[model samples]
Target: MEIDWIWGLLGGLLIGSGGAVYLLANGRIMGASGIIGGLVDGSGHATGGERLSFLAGVVTLPFLLTLMFGAVATHITGNLAVLVIAGLLVGIGTRLANGCTSGHGVCGISRLSLRGLVATCIYIAAGVFTVVLFRHLLGIV
Candidate 1:
């Protein structure tokens, strides 16, 4: 396999392991949106300590890695308006769906929840369509 595939596999395994750990330890789904949303909305105040610690780890570990290694280069669109709109749309979608990809795709699907399965399918289809429409049809890529 290619190095990219190897890294992807490792990353996926780590993500799944983290999700499993969160569920087993805290009885919570390891969804980034849910975690952050709860904290933002003050709902996480009930389990403030755990939420805070988890967020801290999420924020700190990445910076620590970058400091130890090097910054992973990324390409983002120069359009700030597009970026802002995209973020807002994603936030709205997550709220409407009552969960994010991590919760639905990883934790929920693992437990054979129909909602998760359906949501994952729908989102995947939407993503594929979006990519095709933009990259192939409009040459946006």
Candidate 2:
């Protein structure tokens, strides 16, 4: 069968639960970029174990799922240059915003944070604009 809303619902619940657990257990926001950034910038050494464990779960769980359910192709472009440029752009955007969608959209909104709400709005708008501009207008993506 094709994808269904139930999978999305389950994923959302899992993400929200994980964010809540991380916040309650660590007393800190669970931003994926921030977690990895701390390691790259040497600022998260104090909590390196937690970060590493979280990262491990993030990577491993998806592989386990794919193993059980079969591979789900993203159908993304295989061009290395395009992929690298996209990665760099994402990193720059994430840094400029001070957080990613998970940080602002999930954790921040959950706590009624104004910044999070605003950030999430901006993120969604930007994503929509990008898709329209690239896929529809320019036909470049």
Candidate 3:
């Protein structure tokens, strides 16, 4: 209904298509969270230079986009502690699960992997429960 919604959909489509293309062409899934986690852990799969470049791209792309488009980004006014904790939790979860949402939900699902299906279901359920718990039960948004 809104222009923002259309833009968001277009962005999602581009991301999904790019991810699929990357996977098909390179045989590597494009999962940002997993990539960052791997870089932090230094798991021997990705080199230091590669990891740093990936991190830089992830961090700087948004700024570059904003600079080019002159769009006002939404400010996330929240406690830094909460944000850090949430990021840590997500990092741990992805490590434990062996993949992040984009890896399992998009790449895995497209490949018809059973593990991906189950992981995606659990991911959605957990996300829903978290939202309900925080917004309704705890009265926090």
C-alpha local distance difference test of each model: 0.85, 0.87, 0.78
* True-structure RMSD for candidate 3: 2.3
Question: TM per model?
Answer: 0.90, 0.90, 0.82
In terms of lDDT, model 1 sits at: 0.85
Rank order by lDDT, top first? 2, 1, 3
Residues 12-131, candidate 3: write the lDDT tens digits. 898798687656765667777676777778783655565566568767988898899887757664878768877888888988887787888877887898988999999899989998
Cα error of candidate 2 at position 58, Å: 0.4
Task: Point out where model 3 deviates above 4 Å.
Answer: 45-48, 75-77
Across residues 1-141, which tens digit of lDDT does each residue of candidate 2 receive?
Answer: 467788888999999999989988888788988888888888789999999999999999999999999998999988787789889987877767778888988888988999889989988898899889989998767
lDDT of 1 by residue, 48-138 (tens): 7887888898889889999999988778877787688778988888877877789888887999999999999998898899889978998
Predict model 3's lDDT versus the native. Answer: 0.78
Q: Let me know the TM-score candidate 2 reaches against the reference structure.
A: 0.90
Estimate the overall C-alpha local distance difference test score of candidate 2.
0.87
Compare the candidates by lDDT and give the number of the best one.
2
Clashing pairs in 3: none
